[model samples]
Target: MSKIALFGASGTIGSRVRREALDRGHQVTAVVRDPRKITEEHPALTVVTGEVLDAASVAAVAEGHDVVVSAVGGGDGPGHQATIKPAAEVLVEGLRSLGTDAPRLIAVGGAGSLRTPDGAQVWDADGLPEFVLQIMHAHGDALDFYRTVGDVRWTCLSPAAQIEPGERTGRYRTAVDDLIVGADGQSRISAEDYAVALVDEIEDPRHVGERFTVGD
Candidate 1:
Protein backbone atom coordinates (compact mmCIF):
# COMPACT_ATOMS: atom_id res chain seq x y z
CA MET A 1 0.00 0.00 0.00
CA SER A 2 1.18 3.53 -0.77
CA LYS A 3 1.85 6.07 1.95
CA ILE A 4 0.08 9.26 0.84
CA ALA A 5 0.33 12.79 2.18
CA LEU A 6 -2.96 14.44 1.27
CA PHE A 7 -3.69 18.18 1.20
CA GLY A 8 -7.16 19.71 1.36
CA ALA A 9 -8.56 16.57 2.98
CA SER A 10 -11.51 18.46 4.41
CA GLY A 11 -12.95 19.44 1.04
CA THR A 12 -15.55 17.39 -0.82
CA ILE A 13 -13.28 15.61 -3.29
CA GLY A 14 -10.49 15.40 -0.76
CA SER A 15 -12.70 13.72 1.84
CA ARG A 16 -13.85 11.14 -0.66
CA VAL A 17 -10.27 10.56 -1.76
CA ARG A 18 -9.29 10.07 1.85
CA ARG A 19 -12.01 7.47 2.38
CA GLU A 20 -11.20 5.67 -0.83
CA ALA A 21 -7.50 5.53 0.04
CA LEU A 22 -8.15 4.20 3.50
CA ASP A 23 -10.63 1.59 2.22
CA ARG A 24 -7.97 0.33 -0.15
CA GLY A 25 -5.55 -0.24 2.76
CA HIS A 26 -3.24 2.67 1.95
CA GLN A 27 -1.91 4.88 4.71
CA VAL A 28 -2.95 8.54 4.54
CA THR A 29 -1.84 11.63 6.42
CA ALA A 30 -4.58 14.21 5.98
CA VAL A 31 -2.95 17.62 6.19
CA VAL A 32 -5.36 20.48 6.67
CA ARG A 33 -5.42 24.04 7.99
CA ASP A 34 -7.24 22.88 11.11
CA PRO A 35 -6.83 19.33 12.34
CA ARG A 36 -10.15 19.32 14.23
CA LYS A 37 -12.11 19.68 11.01
CA ILE A 38 -11.39 16.05 10.17
CA THR A 39 -13.38 13.96 12.62
CA GLU A 40 -13.28 10.65 10.81
CA GLU A 41 -11.37 7.97 12.69
CA HIS A 42 -9.55 5.36 10.70
CA PRO A 43 -6.73 2.96 11.31
CA ALA A 44 -4.87 4.22 8.27
CA LEU A 45 -5.63 7.92 8.57
CA THR A 46 -3.75 10.70 10.37
CA VAL A 47 -4.94 14.31 10.47
CA VAL A 48 -2.46 17.13 10.95
CA THR A 49 -2.44 20.92 10.66
CA GLY A 50 -0.73 22.26 7.58
CA GLU A 51 -0.64 25.21 5.19
CA VAL A 52 -0.56 24.11 1.55
CA LEU A 53 0.58 27.53 0.33
CA ASP A 54 3.81 27.31 2.29
CA ALA A 55 6.63 25.39 0.68
CA ALA A 56 8.24 24.60 4.03
CA SER A 57 5.03 23.09 5.35
CA VAL A 58 4.66 21.05 2.20
CA ALA A 59 8.19 19.67 2.49
CA ALA A 60 7.82 18.89 6.17
CA VAL A 61 4.67 16.80 5.64
CA ALA A 62 5.74 15.43 2.28
CA GLU A 63 8.93 13.80 3.53
CA GLY A 64 8.87 9.98 3.69
CA HIS A 65 5.52 9.72 1.88
CA ASP A 66 5.23 7.62 -1.26
CA VAL A 67 3.00 10.17 -2.99
CA VAL A 68 1.67 13.65 -2.25
CA VAL A 69 -1.90 14.16 -3.38
CA SER A 70 -3.44 17.63 -3.54
CA ALA A 71 -7.23 17.78 -3.80
CA VAL A 72 -7.19 21.55 -3.97
CA GLY A 73 -9.07 23.00 -6.97
CA GLY A 74 -10.98 19.76 -7.51
CA GLY A 75 -14.19 20.97 -5.86
CA ASP A 76 -16.02 24.12 -4.86
CA GLY A 77 -13.63 25.23 -2.17
CA PRO A 78 -12.99 28.86 -1.26
CA GLY A 79 -9.91 30.97 -1.94
CA HIS A 80 -9.70 30.64 -5.68
CA GLN A 81 -6.32 32.37 -5.78
CA ALA A 82 -4.74 30.22 -3.07
CA THR A 83 -6.14 26.87 -4.22
CA ILE A 84 -5.16 26.50 -7.86
CA LYS A 85 -2.02 27.86 -9.51
CA PRO A 86 -0.26 29.15 -6.42
CA ALA A 87 -0.75 25.82 -4.68
CA ALA A 88 0.79 24.05 -7.63
CA GLU A 89 3.82 26.33 -7.56
CA VAL A 90 4.40 25.89 -3.86
CA LEU A 91 3.92 22.12 -4.03
CA VAL A 92 6.57 21.77 -6.69
CA GLU A 93 8.94 24.07 -4.84
CA GLY A 94 8.46 22.14 -1.62
CA LEU A 95 8.93 18.78 -3.32
CA ARG A 96 12.03 20.04 -5.00
CA SER A 97 13.69 20.74 -1.66
CA LEU A 98 13.54 17.04 -0.78
CA GLY A 99 15.86 16.08 -3.61
CA THR A 100 15.71 12.37 -4.40
CA ASP A 101 13.59 11.57 -1.35
CA ALA A 102 10.54 13.40 -2.71
CA PRO A 103 7.45 11.45 -3.59
CA ARG A 104 5.44 11.80 -6.76
CA LEU A 105 2.93 14.69 -6.91
CA ILE A 106 -0.68 14.17 -7.97
CA ALA A 107 -2.78 17.35 -8.07
CA VAL A 108 -6.43 17.98 -8.88
CA GLY A 109 -6.86 20.09 -12.01
CA GLY A 110 -9.66 21.80 -13.99
CA ALA A 111 -11.41 20.72 -17.19
CA GLY A 112 -11.25 24.18 -18.78
CA SER A 113 -8.15 23.43 -20.78
CA LEU A 114 -9.45 20.17 -22.19
CA ARG A 115 -10.51 20.31 -25.81
CA THR A 116 -14.13 19.60 -26.62
CA PRO A 117 -15.35 17.51 -29.55
CA ASP A 118 -16.71 20.57 -31.28
CA GLY A 119 -13.24 22.22 -31.41
CA ALA A 120 -13.83 24.49 -28.42
CA GLN A 121 -12.54 24.31 -24.84
CA VAL A 122 -14.78 23.90 -21.83
CA TRP A 123 -14.19 27.45 -20.60
CA ASP A 124 -14.82 28.76 -24.07
CA ALA A 125 -18.47 27.81 -23.83
CA ASP A 126 -20.85 30.73 -23.51
CA GLY A 127 -22.38 32.14 -20.32
CA LEU A 128 -19.99 30.76 -17.70
CA PRO A 129 -20.10 32.60 -14.40
CA GLU A 130 -17.22 34.88 -13.46
CA PHE A 131 -16.24 32.68 -10.53
CA VAL A 132 -16.15 29.52 -12.63
CA LEU A 133 -14.19 31.24 -15.35
CA GLN A 134 -11.69 32.39 -12.77
CA ILE A 135 -11.25 28.90 -11.33
CA MET A 136 -10.92 27.45 -14.78
CA HIS A 137 -8.26 29.95 -15.76
CA ALA A 138 -6.41 29.36 -12.54
CA HIS A 139 -6.32 25.65 -13.21
CA GLY A 140 -5.21 26.24 -16.75
CA ASP A 141 -2.40 28.45 -15.48
CA ALA A 142 -1.38 25.80 -12.97
CA LEU A 143 -1.33 23.19 -15.72
CA ASP A 144 0.87 25.42 -17.81
CA PHE A 145 3.27 25.70 -14.89
CA TYR A 146 3.24 21.95 -14.37
CA ARG A 147 4.07 21.37 -18.01
CA THR A 148 7.31 23.33 -17.59
CA VAL A 149 8.58 21.30 -14.66
CA GLY A 150 10.74 18.33 -15.65
CA ASP A 151 12.66 17.63 -12.46
CA VAL A 152 9.68 16.88 -10.26
CA ARG A 153 7.49 13.95 -11.25
CA TRP A 154 3.99 15.39 -11.37
CA THR A 155 0.54 14.41 -12.67
CA CYS A 156 -2.61 16.52 -12.87
CA LEU A 157 -6.09 14.93 -12.98
CA SER A 158 -8.85 17.14 -14.33
CA PRO A 159 -12.42 16.21 -13.49
CA ALA A 160 -15.33 16.14 -15.91
CA ALA A 161 -17.40 19.20 -16.85
CA GLN A 162 -19.98 18.24 -14.26
CA ILE A 163 -18.82 16.55 -11.04
CA GLU A 164 -20.69 16.30 -7.77
CA PRO A 165 -21.08 14.18 -4.67
CA GLY A 166 -22.81 11.07 -5.98
CA GLU A 167 -22.67 7.28 -5.73
CA ARG A 168 -19.42 5.52 -6.38
CA THR A 169 -20.10 3.24 -9.32
CA GLY A 170 -16.41 2.32 -9.52
CA ARG A 171 -16.52 2.75 -13.26
CA TYR A 172 -15.49 5.65 -15.51
CA ARG A 173 -13.74 6.43 -18.76
CA THR A 174 -10.43 8.30 -19.13
CA ALA A 175 -8.98 10.72 -21.63
CA VAL A 176 -5.94 12.94 -22.13
CA ASP A 177 -6.36 16.61 -23.11
CA ASP A 178 -9.85 15.92 -24.48
CA LEU A 179 -13.17 16.07 -22.66
CA ILE A 180 -14.85 12.68 -22.02
CA VAL A 181 -18.50 12.92 -23.06
CA GLY A 182 -20.77 9.95 -22.53
CA ALA A 183 -23.43 8.61 -24.91
CA ASP A 184 -25.91 10.93 -23.19
CA GLY A 185 -23.99 13.90 -24.53
CA GLN A 186 -22.95 14.99 -21.08
CA SER A 187 -19.67 15.00 -19.19
CA ARG A 188 -19.94 14.02 -15.56
CA ILE A 189 -18.66 11.69 -12.87
CA SER A 190 -19.44 11.18 -9.22
CA ALA A 191 -16.78 12.54 -6.91
CA GLU A 192 -16.52 9.08 -5.32
CA ASP A 193 -15.68 7.43 -8.61
CA TYR A 194 -13.23 10.24 -9.30
CA ALA A 195 -11.55 9.28 -6.06
CA VAL A 196 -11.42 5.71 -7.28
CA ALA A 197 -9.72 6.80 -10.46
CA LEU A 198 -7.23 8.86 -8.46
CA VAL A 199 -6.32 6.10 -6.03
CA ASP A 200 -6.03 3.71 -8.94
CA GLU A 201 -3.57 6.12 -10.46
CA ILE A 202 -1.64 6.23 -7.19
CA GLU A 203 -1.34 2.44 -7.30
CA ASP A 204 -0.66 2.08 -11.02
CA PRO A 205 1.17 5.35 -11.83
CA ARG A 206 0.06 5.63 -15.48
CA HIS A 207 -0.27 9.29 -16.45
CA VAL A 208 2.94 10.47 -14.86
CA GLY A 209 4.32 13.79 -16.18
CA GLU A 210 1.01 14.47 -17.90
CA ARG A 211 -2.65 15.37 -17.27
CA PHE A 212 -5.72 13.12 -17.64
CA THR A 213 -9.50 13.55 -17.17
CA VAL A 214 -12.27 11.18 -16.05
CA GLY A 215 -16.02 10.94 -16.80
CA ASP A 216 -18.92 8.58 -16.24
Candidate 2:
Protein backbone atom coordinates (compact mmCIF):
# COMPACT_ATOMS: atom_id res chain seq x y z
CA MET A 1 0.00 0.00 0.00
CA SER A 2 1.17 3.53 -0.74
CA LYS A 3 2.21 5.62 2.24
CA ILE A 4 0.76 9.10 1.75
CA ALA A 5 1.43 12.40 3.44
CA LEU A 6 -1.94 14.10 2.90
CA PHE A 7 -2.38 17.86 2.98
CA GLY A 8 -5.78 19.57 3.31
CA ALA A 9 -7.26 16.49 4.97
CA SER A 10 -9.94 18.46 6.76
CA GLY A 11 -11.75 19.79 3.70
CA THR A 12 -14.55 18.18 1.70
CA ILE A 13 -12.51 16.60 -1.09
CA GLY A 14 -9.67 15.81 1.26
CA SER A 15 -11.98 14.06 3.71
CA ARG A 16 -13.33 11.79 1.02
CA VAL A 17 -9.84 11.10 -0.24
CA ARG A 18 -8.80 10.23 3.30
CA ARG A 19 -11.65 7.75 3.71
CA GLU A 20 -10.92 6.20 0.34
CA ALA A 21 -7.27 5.79 1.27
CA LEU A 22 -8.23 4.01 4.46
CA ASP A 23 -10.63 1.74 2.58
CA ARG A 24 -7.79 0.82 0.26
CA GLY A 25 -5.59 -0.04 3.29
CA HIS A 26 -2.92 2.56 2.71
CA GLN A 27 -1.28 4.41 5.58
CA VAL A 28 -1.92 8.15 5.69
CA THR A 29 -0.06 10.81 7.62
CA ALA A 30 -2.74 13.49 7.61
CA VAL A 31 -1.00 16.86 7.63
CA VAL A 32 -3.46 19.46 8.79
CA ARG A 33 -3.18 22.97 10.17
CA ASP A 34 -4.77 21.79 13.42
CA PRO A 35 -4.90 18.17 14.46
CA ARG A 36 -7.62 18.78 17.05
CA LYS A 37 -9.95 19.97 14.29
CA ILE A 38 -10.39 16.42 13.16
CA THR A 39 -13.87 15.06 13.94
CA GLU A 40 -13.10 11.44 13.17
CA GLU A 41 -10.09 9.19 13.64
CA HIS A 42 -8.71 6.10 11.98
CA PRO A 43 -6.00 3.74 13.12
CA ALA A 44 -4.30 3.85 9.73
CA LEU A 45 -4.19 7.62 9.89
CA THR A 46 -1.67 9.85 11.69
CA VAL A 47 -2.21 13.58 12.10
CA VAL A 48 0.49 16.26 11.86
CA THR A 49 -0.22 19.91 12.58
CA GLY A 50 1.45 22.75 10.64
CA GLU A 51 1.11 25.32 7.86
CA VAL A 52 1.17 24.33 4.18
CA LEU A 53 3.05 27.45 3.14
CA ASP A 54 6.10 26.64 5.21
CA ALA A 55 8.40 24.43 3.15
CA ALA A 56 10.43 23.28 6.12
CA SER A 57 7.33 22.48 8.14
CA VAL A 58 5.69 20.70 5.22
CA ALA A 59 8.84 18.76 4.45
CA ALA A 60 9.08 17.67 8.05
CA VAL A 61 5.57 16.24 7.74
CA ALA A 62 6.44 14.65 4.41
CA GLU A 63 9.30 12.57 5.69
CA GLY A 64 8.83 8.80 5.28
CA HIS A 65 5.74 9.24 3.10
CA ASP A 66 5.81 7.93 -0.44
CA VAL A 67 3.44 10.46 -1.98
CA VAL A 68 1.79 13.78 -1.10
CA VAL A 69 -1.77 14.68 -2.00
CA SER A 70 -3.08 18.22 -1.61
CA ALA A 71 -6.82 18.94 -1.76
CA VAL A 72 -6.33 22.62 -1.19
CA GLY A 73 -9.15 25.03 -2.12
CA GLY A 74 -9.39 28.74 -2.76
CA GLY A 75 -12.69 29.97 -1.42
CA ASP A 76 -13.51 32.86 0.91
CA GLY A 77 -11.36 33.55 3.97
CA PRO A 78 -9.09 30.64 4.92
CA GLY A 79 -9.68 28.81 1.67
CA HIS A 80 -8.56 31.83 -0.28
CA GLN A 81 -5.33 32.00 1.70
CA ALA A 82 -4.67 28.34 1.03
CA THR A 83 -5.47 28.65 -2.70
CA ILE A 84 -3.58 31.87 -3.35
CA LYS A 85 -0.28 32.01 -5.22
CA PRO A 86 1.75 31.72 -2.03
CA ALA A 87 0.33 28.30 -1.32
CA ALA A 88 1.48 27.05 -4.71
CA GLU A 89 4.93 28.56 -4.27
CA VAL A 90 5.24 26.97 -0.88
CA LEU A 91 4.27 23.55 -2.17
CA VAL A 92 6.49 23.79 -5.27
CA GLU A 93 9.57 24.65 -3.26
CA GLY A 94 8.61 22.27 -0.48
CA LEU A 95 8.35 19.41 -2.93
CA ARG A 96 11.71 20.37 -4.41
CA SER A 97 13.41 20.23 -1.02
CA LEU A 98 12.14 16.72 -0.60
CA GLY A 99 15.32 16.08 -2.61
CA THR A 100 14.62 15.80 -6.35
CA ASP A 101 13.32 12.22 -6.19
CA ALA A 102 11.34 11.91 -3.03
CA PRO A 103 7.60 12.08 -2.46
CA ARG A 104 5.57 12.34 -5.64
CA LEU A 105 3.09 15.22 -5.38
CA ILE A 106 -0.48 15.38 -6.58
CA ALA A 107 -2.34 18.68 -6.46
CA VAL A 108 -6.08 19.32 -6.67
CA GLY A 109 -6.39 21.78 -9.55
CA GLY A 110 -9.41 23.70 -10.78
CA ALA A 111 -11.70 22.73 -13.63
CA GLY A 112 -11.80 26.30 -14.91
CA SER A 113 -8.73 25.68 -17.00
CA LEU A 114 -10.40 22.90 -18.92
CA ARG A 115 -11.34 23.47 -22.55
CA THR A 116 -14.82 24.16 -23.85
CA PRO A 117 -16.30 24.06 -27.35
CA ASP A 118 -14.69 26.20 -30.07
CA GLY A 119 -11.33 25.98 -28.16
CA ALA A 120 -11.82 28.45 -25.32
CA GLN A 121 -11.33 27.54 -21.66
CA VAL A 122 -14.40 26.62 -19.66
CA TRP A 123 -13.97 29.74 -17.59
CA ASP A 124 -13.75 31.79 -20.76
CA ALA A 125 -17.01 30.51 -22.15
CA ASP A 126 -19.77 32.85 -23.25
CA GLY A 127 -21.66 34.66 -20.49
CA LEU A 128 -19.43 33.21 -17.78
CA PRO A 129 -19.76 35.06 -14.50
CA GLU A 130 -16.94 37.47 -13.62
CA PHE A 131 -16.31 36.06 -10.15
CA VAL A 132 -16.01 32.51 -11.45
CA LEU A 133 -13.51 33.52 -14.08
CA GLN A 134 -11.50 35.34 -11.43
CA ILE A 135 -10.75 32.25 -9.37
CA MET A 136 -10.12 30.17 -12.44
CA HIS A 137 -7.47 32.62 -13.52
CA ALA A 138 -6.02 32.42 -10.04
CA HIS A 139 -5.62 28.65 -10.25
CA GLY A 140 -4.15 28.94 -13.74
CA ASP A 141 -1.57 31.35 -12.35
CA ALA A 142 -0.65 28.90 -9.60
CA LEU A 143 -0.15 26.08 -12.08
CA ASP A 144 1.78 28.39 -14.37
CA PHE A 145 4.37 28.88 -11.63
CA TYR A 146 4.61 25.13 -11.22
CA ARG A 147 5.62 24.69 -14.86
CA THR A 148 8.76 26.81 -14.36
CA VAL A 149 10.15 24.41 -11.79
CA GLY A 150 11.70 20.98 -12.27
CA ASP A 151 12.82 18.24 -9.84
CA VAL A 152 9.20 18.07 -8.70
CA ARG A 153 7.44 14.79 -9.47
CA TRP A 154 3.90 15.99 -9.85
CA THR A 155 0.63 15.68 -11.77
CA CYS A 156 -2.66 17.52 -11.36
CA LEU A 157 -6.22 16.15 -11.30
CA SER A 158 -9.10 18.29 -12.61
CA PRO A 159 -12.39 16.63 -11.86
CA ALA A 160 -15.41 16.49 -14.18
CA ALA A 161 -16.93 19.82 -15.16
CA GLN A 162 -18.91 19.56 -11.93
CA ILE A 163 -17.89 17.76 -8.72
CA GLU A 164 -20.09 17.13 -5.68
CA PRO A 165 -20.96 14.59 -3.03
CA GLY A 166 -22.52 11.39 -4.38
CA GLU A 167 -22.12 7.62 -4.63
CA ARG A 168 -18.94 5.84 -5.69
CA THR A 169 -19.79 3.87 -8.76
CA GLY A 170 -16.11 3.64 -9.76
CA ARG A 171 -17.46 4.40 -13.19
CA TYR A 172 -16.14 7.54 -14.88
CA ARG A 173 -14.42 8.49 -18.09
CA THR A 174 -10.81 9.66 -18.11
CA ALA A 175 -9.25 12.10 -20.53
CA VAL A 176 -5.75 13.37 -21.01
CA ASP A 177 -6.12 16.87 -22.49
CA ASP A 178 -9.82 17.71 -22.40
CA LEU A 179 -12.70 17.64 -19.90
CA ILE A 180 -15.20 14.79 -20.18
CA VAL A 181 -18.89 15.62 -20.60
CA GLY A 182 -21.85 13.27 -20.67
CA ALA A 183 -24.13 12.87 -23.68
CA ASP A 184 -26.59 15.33 -22.19
CA GLY A 185 -23.82 17.95 -22.21
CA GLN A 186 -23.51 18.44 -18.44
CA SER A 187 -20.28 17.27 -16.84
CA ARG A 188 -20.83 16.18 -13.26
CA ILE A 189 -18.82 13.73 -11.21
CA SER A 190 -19.31 12.42 -7.70
CA ALA A 191 -16.70 13.21 -5.06
CA GLU A 192 -16.51 9.55 -4.13
CA ASP A 193 -15.75 8.52 -7.69
CA TYR A 194 -13.22 11.30 -7.92
CA ALA A 195 -11.55 9.82 -4.88
CA VAL A 196 -11.48 6.51 -6.70
CA ALA A 197 -9.67 8.13 -9.61
CA LEU A 198 -7.19 9.89 -7.35
CA VAL A 199 -6.32 6.79 -5.33
CA ASP A 200 -6.08 4.68 -8.43
CA GLU A 201 -3.59 7.11 -9.89
CA ILE A 202 -1.66 6.99 -6.61
CA GLU A 203 -1.38 3.22 -6.87
CA ASP A 204 -0.34 3.24 -10.52
CA PRO A 205 1.57 6.10 -12.07
CA ARG A 206 0.03 7.56 -15.24
CA HIS A 207 -0.57 11.01 -16.77
CA VAL A 208 2.69 12.42 -15.40
CA GLY A 209 3.42 15.92 -16.77
CA GLU A 210 -0.05 15.73 -18.27
CA ARG A 211 -3.45 16.97 -17.11
CA PHE A 212 -6.46 14.66 -17.09
CA THR A 213 -10.17 15.33 -16.36
CA VAL A 214 -12.87 12.85 -15.36
CA GLY A 215 -16.69 12.80 -15.68
CA ASP A 216 -19.71 10.49 -15.82
Candidate 3:
Protein backbone atom coordinates (compact mmCIF):
# COMPACT_ATOMS: atom_id res chain seq x y z
CA MET A 1 0.00 0.00 0.00
CA SER A 2 1.26 3.45 -0.87
CA LYS A 3 0.90 6.77 0.90
CA ILE A 4 -1.07 9.21 -1.21
CA ALA A 5 -1.64 12.92 -0.75
CA LEU A 6 -5.10 13.80 -1.97
CA PHE A 7 -6.62 17.20 -2.68
CA GLY A 8 -10.31 17.94 -3.07
CA ALA A 9 -11.33 15.16 -0.70
CA SER A 10 -14.73 16.72 -0.16
CA GLY A 11 -15.61 16.77 -3.83
CA THR A 12 -17.37 14.06 -5.80
CA ILE A 13 -14.50 12.18 -7.44
CA GLY A 14 -12.11 13.02 -4.64
CA SER A 15 -14.49 11.65 -1.99
CA ARG A 16 -14.85 8.34 -3.81
CA VAL A 17 -11.13 8.16 -4.47
CA ARG A 18 -10.29 8.79 -0.84
CA ARG A 19 -12.56 5.89 0.14
CA GLU A 20 -11.12 3.66 -2.53
CA ALA A 21 -7.57 4.37 -1.46
CA LEU A 22 -8.38 3.58 2.13
CA ASP A 23 -10.42 0.51 1.14
CA ARG A 24 -7.35 -0.80 -0.68
CA GLY A 25 -5.28 -0.54 2.48
CA HIS A 26 -3.39 2.52 1.33
CA GLN A 27 -2.76 5.59 3.45
CA VAL A 28 -4.30 8.90 2.48
CA THR A 29 -3.79 12.46 3.71
CA ALA A 30 -6.43 14.76 2.34
CA VAL A 31 -5.51 18.44 2.12
CA VAL A 32 -8.50 20.70 2.14
CA ARG A 33 -9.26 24.41 2.25
CA ASP A 34 -11.65 24.01 5.14
CA PRO A 35 -11.93 21.40 7.87
CA ARG A 36 -15.66 21.64 8.51
CA LYS A 37 -16.33 20.78 4.90
CA ILE A 38 -14.63 17.44 5.39
CA THR A 39 -16.60 14.83 7.35
CA GLU A 40 -14.75 11.63 6.54
CA GLU A 41 -12.79 10.22 9.42
CA HIS A 42 -10.55 7.32 8.51
CA PRO A 43 -8.07 5.77 10.85
CA ALA A 44 -5.80 5.22 7.93
CA LEU A 45 -6.30 8.74 6.62
CA THR A 46 -5.21 12.16 7.80
CA VAL A 47 -7.23 15.20 6.89
CA VAL A 48 -5.01 18.27 6.69
CA THR A 49 -6.97 21.45 6.38
CA GLY A 50 -5.20 24.04 4.23
CA GLU A 51 -5.31 25.94 1.00
CA VAL A 52 -4.65 23.87 -2.11
CA LEU A 53 -3.94 27.17 -3.83
CA ASP A 54 -1.02 27.82 -1.53
CA ALA A 55 2.12 26.10 -2.69
CA ALA A 56 3.59 26.03 0.79
CA SER A 57 0.52 24.38 2.29
CA VAL A 58 0.37 21.87 -0.55
CA ALA A 59 4.07 21.10 -0.32
CA ALA A 60 3.76 20.50 3.39
CA VAL A 61 1.10 17.86 2.88
CA ALA A 62 2.78 16.41 -0.17
CA GLU A 63 5.94 15.67 1.71
CA GLY A 64 6.60 11.97 2.39
CA HIS A 65 3.90 10.92 -0.05
CA ASP A 66 4.33 8.17 -2.59
CA VAL A 67 1.81 9.72 -4.96
CA VAL A 68 -0.34 12.78 -5.29
CA VAL A 69 -3.77 12.66 -6.90
CA SER A 70 -5.81 15.81 -7.25
CA ALA A 71 -9.54 15.55 -7.87
CA VAL A 72 -10.19 19.22 -7.20
CA GLY A 73 -12.76 21.16 -9.18
CA GLY A 74 -13.04 24.91 -9.03
CA GLY A 75 -16.31 26.49 -7.94
CA ASP A 76 -18.21 28.21 -5.15
CA GLY A 77 -20.31 25.02 -5.18
CA PRO A 78 -20.25 24.26 -8.83
CA GLY A 79 -20.13 27.40 -10.94
CA HIS A 80 -17.25 29.60 -9.83
CA GLN A 81 -13.60 29.98 -10.89
CA ALA A 82 -12.31 31.01 -7.49
CA THR A 83 -11.60 27.40 -6.56
CA ILE A 84 -9.91 25.82 -9.57
CA LYS A 85 -7.34 27.89 -11.44
CA PRO A 86 -5.59 28.95 -8.30
CA ALA A 87 -5.44 25.35 -7.14
CA ALA A 88 -3.85 24.25 -10.37
CA GLU A 89 -1.26 26.97 -10.22
CA VAL A 90 -0.46 26.11 -6.64
CA LEU A 91 -0.24 22.37 -7.25
CA VAL A 92 2.14 22.85 -10.12
CA GLU A 93 4.49 25.02 -8.13
CA GLY A 94 4.07 22.84 -5.07
CA LEU A 95 5.30 19.80 -6.96
CA ARG A 96 8.14 21.79 -8.42
CA SER A 97 9.21 23.08 -5.04
CA LEU A 98 9.20 19.62 -3.45
CA GLY A 99 12.89 19.53 -4.43
CA THR A 100 12.70 15.76 -4.04
CA ASP A 101 12.14 13.27 -6.81
CA ALA A 102 10.04 10.86 -4.80
CA PRO A 103 6.30 11.23 -5.29
CA ARG A 104 4.39 10.80 -8.52
CA LEU A 105 1.73 13.44 -9.22
CA ILE A 106 -1.42 12.95 -11.22
CA ALA A 107 -4.14 15.54 -11.50
CA VAL A 108 -7.60 15.12 -12.97
CA GLY A 109 -7.76 16.43 -16.52
CA GLY A 110 -10.75 17.41 -18.66
CA ALA A 111 -12.59 15.66 -21.44
CA GLY A 112 -13.02 18.95 -23.24
CA SER A 113 -9.50 18.74 -24.63
CA LEU A 114 -10.32 15.36 -26.12
CA ARG A 115 -11.49 14.97 -29.68
CA THR A 116 -15.14 15.13 -30.62
CA PRO A 117 -17.25 13.27 -33.19
CA ASP A 118 -16.14 15.79 -35.74
CA GLY A 119 -12.54 14.60 -35.48
CA ALA A 120 -11.55 17.94 -34.05
CA GLN A 121 -10.33 18.81 -30.58
CA VAL A 122 -12.83 20.67 -28.45
CA TRP A 123 -11.99 23.36 -25.92
CA ASP A 124 -13.71 24.88 -22.93
CA ALA A 125 -16.49 27.13 -24.10
CA ASP A 126 -18.91 29.66 -22.65
CA GLY A 127 -21.97 27.72 -23.83
CA LEU A 128 -21.41 25.11 -21.15
CA PRO A 129 -22.64 25.87 -17.65
CA GLU A 130 -20.18 27.58 -15.31
CA PHE A 131 -19.60 24.59 -13.06
CA VAL A 132 -19.18 22.16 -15.91
CA LEU A 133 -16.70 24.32 -17.74
CA GLN A 134 -14.68 25.42 -14.75
CA ILE A 135 -12.90 22.14 -14.18
CA MET A 136 -12.45 21.68 -17.89
CA HIS A 137 -10.29 24.75 -18.19
CA ALA A 138 -8.64 24.19 -14.85
CA HIS A 139 -7.56 20.69 -15.75
CA GLY A 140 -6.48 21.81 -19.12
CA ASP A 141 -4.32 24.46 -17.50
CA ALA A 142 -3.04 21.96 -14.94
CA LEU A 143 -1.99 19.52 -17.62
CA ASP A 144 -0.36 22.28 -19.57
CA PHE A 145 1.60 23.40 -16.53
CA TYR A 146 2.73 19.86 -15.82
CA ARG A 147 4.34 19.72 -19.22
CA THR A 148 7.18 21.92 -17.95
CA VAL A 149 7.97 19.86 -14.87
CA GLY A 150 11.27 18.71 -16.41
CA ASP A 151 11.45 15.52 -14.31
CA VAL A 152 8.13 14.91 -12.62
CA ARG A 153 6.18 11.70 -13.36
CA TRP A 154 2.76 12.78 -14.48
CA THR A 155 -0.24 11.45 -16.36
CA CYS A 156 -3.25 13.65 -16.93
CA LEU A 157 -6.20 11.28 -17.22
CA SER A 158 -8.86 12.76 -19.42
CA PRO A 159 -12.29 11.23 -19.02
CA ALA A 160 -14.70 10.16 -21.74
CA ALA A 161 -17.38 12.34 -23.31
CA GLN A 162 -19.62 11.85 -20.29
CA ILE A 163 -18.67 11.35 -16.64
CA GLU A 164 -21.06 11.18 -13.68
CA PRO A 165 -22.03 9.16 -10.65
CA GLY A 166 -23.01 5.58 -11.40
CA GLU A 167 -22.35 1.94 -10.55
CA ARG A 168 -18.96 0.29 -10.65
CA THR A 169 -18.92 -2.93 -12.66
CA GLY A 170 -15.11 -3.06 -12.68
CA ARG A 171 -15.00 -2.75 -16.43
CA TYR A 172 -14.36 -0.01 -18.98
CA ARG A 173 -12.35 0.53 -22.14
CA THR A 174 -9.41 2.94 -22.23
CA ALA A 175 -8.31 5.15 -25.06
CA VAL A 176 -5.81 7.92 -25.69
CA ASP A 177 -6.34 11.48 -26.95
CA ASP A 178 -9.79 10.99 -28.55
CA LEU A 179 -13.13 10.49 -26.85
CA ILE A 180 -14.37 6.90 -26.37
CA VAL A 181 -18.02 6.63 -27.31
CA GLY A 182 -20.02 3.42 -27.16
CA ALA A 183 -22.02 2.25 -30.13
CA ASP A 184 -25.22 3.12 -28.29
CA GLY A 185 -24.53 6.75 -29.13
CA GLN A 186 -23.12 7.85 -25.78
CA SER A 187 -19.80 8.20 -24.07
CA ARG A 188 -20.22 7.74 -20.36
CA ILE A 189 -18.67 5.90 -17.44
CA SER A 190 -19.60 5.63 -13.80
CA ALA A 191 -17.39 7.36 -11.26
CA GLU A 192 -16.68 3.92 -9.78
CA ASP A 193 -15.20 2.65 -13.01
CA TYR A 194 -13.42 5.92 -13.47
CA ALA A 195 -11.82 5.42 -10.08
CA VAL A 196 -10.79 1.96 -11.18
CA ALA A 197 -8.91 3.41 -14.09
CA LEU A 198 -7.51 6.19 -11.97
CA VAL A 199 -6.14 3.76 -9.39
CA ASP A 200 -4.84 1.42 -12.04
CA GLU A 201 -3.14 4.29 -13.75
CA ILE A 202 -1.68 5.40 -10.48
CA GLU A 203 -0.28 1.96 -9.79
CA ASP A 204 1.04 1.55 -13.29
CA PRO A 205 1.18 4.47 -15.64
CA ARG A 206 0.77 3.63 -19.33
CA HIS A 207 0.24 7.20 -20.35
CA VAL A 208 3.22 8.98 -18.84
CA GLY A 209 4.29 12.13 -20.64
CA GLU A 210 0.85 12.00 -22.30
CA ARG A 211 -2.89 12.16 -21.77
CA PHE A 212 -5.56 9.46 -22.21
CA THR A 213 -9.36 9.28 -22.13
CA VAL A 214 -11.72 6.56 -20.87
CA GLY A 215 -15.12 5.38 -22.13
CA ASP A 216 -17.51 2.45 -22.23
Pairs of residues at least 3 apart in sequence or in different chains that clash in candidate 2 = none
Candidates in order have lDDT scores of 0.93, 0.80, 0.76
What digit string (tens of lDDT, one per residue) describes model 3 on residues 30-74? Answer: 878787887867799898886777888878888899888888874
Clashes of each: 0, 0, 1
- Tens-place lDDT per residue, model 2, 123-205, is 87777666666667777777777667667777788887688989999888888657688889898899999999999999998
The reply for model 1, stretches above 4 Å from the true place, is 74-79
Model 1, 82: alpha-carbon shift in Å? 4.1
lDDT of 1: 0.93
Q: Report residue 96 deviation for candidate 3 (angstroms).
A: 1.6
How do all models score by TM-score?
0.97, 0.92, 0.87
Worst 10-residue lDDT window for candidate 1 reads: 73-82
Sequence-dependent TM-score of model 3: 0.87
